[model samples]
Target: MDKAQIKIYGLLENYLEYCKTNGFTDFEIWCEDNIDSANEKGLVQDIYREVNHIADKLFD
Candidate 1:
């Protein structure tokens, strides 16, 4: 895989571990709450957007 794909994969893996650490097994649910908190904190971009960007980077 390319750098972008590798980065995204790593991020997803990290996120999954984070979810497990927090006792969350559902990715969608975890993402929902994470996205909301990210938005509330005015992060550079929300989790969904980051995921999209990563996807684009991987494919493009």
Candidate 2:
């Protein structure tokens, strides 16, 4: 991952952790902001794809 993707990955990982710790509903109510942030530098899809089940954990 490039620096931007790496940074977004870190941010998304933190969000995923929040979802797991706090419950998915209470976190990431809408992922638009996250997507937009990712789009600023990289694709959120790439991050999710690379992380495998992290997408499921965050958005399943």
Tens-digit lDDT track for model 1 on 1-60?
755445444556766566545543433343444333433333323354555455444433
Query: What is candidate 2's lDDT per residue for 1-60, written digit by digit as tens?
Result: 766666665667677776666654422333345545545334645444544455465565
Looking at model 1, report the run of 10 residues with the lowest lDDT sum. Answer: 36-45
Q: What TM-score quantifies how close candidate 2 is to the native fold?
A: 0.44
The list of candidate 1 runs beyond 4 A from truth reads 23-60
Which TM-score value belongs to model 1?
Answer: 0.39
Model 2 CA deviation exceeding 4 Å by range: 25-42, 45-60
Winning model by TM-score:
2
RMSD of 1: 10.2
Taking every candidate in turn, the Cα RMSD to the unseen true structure, in Å, is 10.2, 4.7
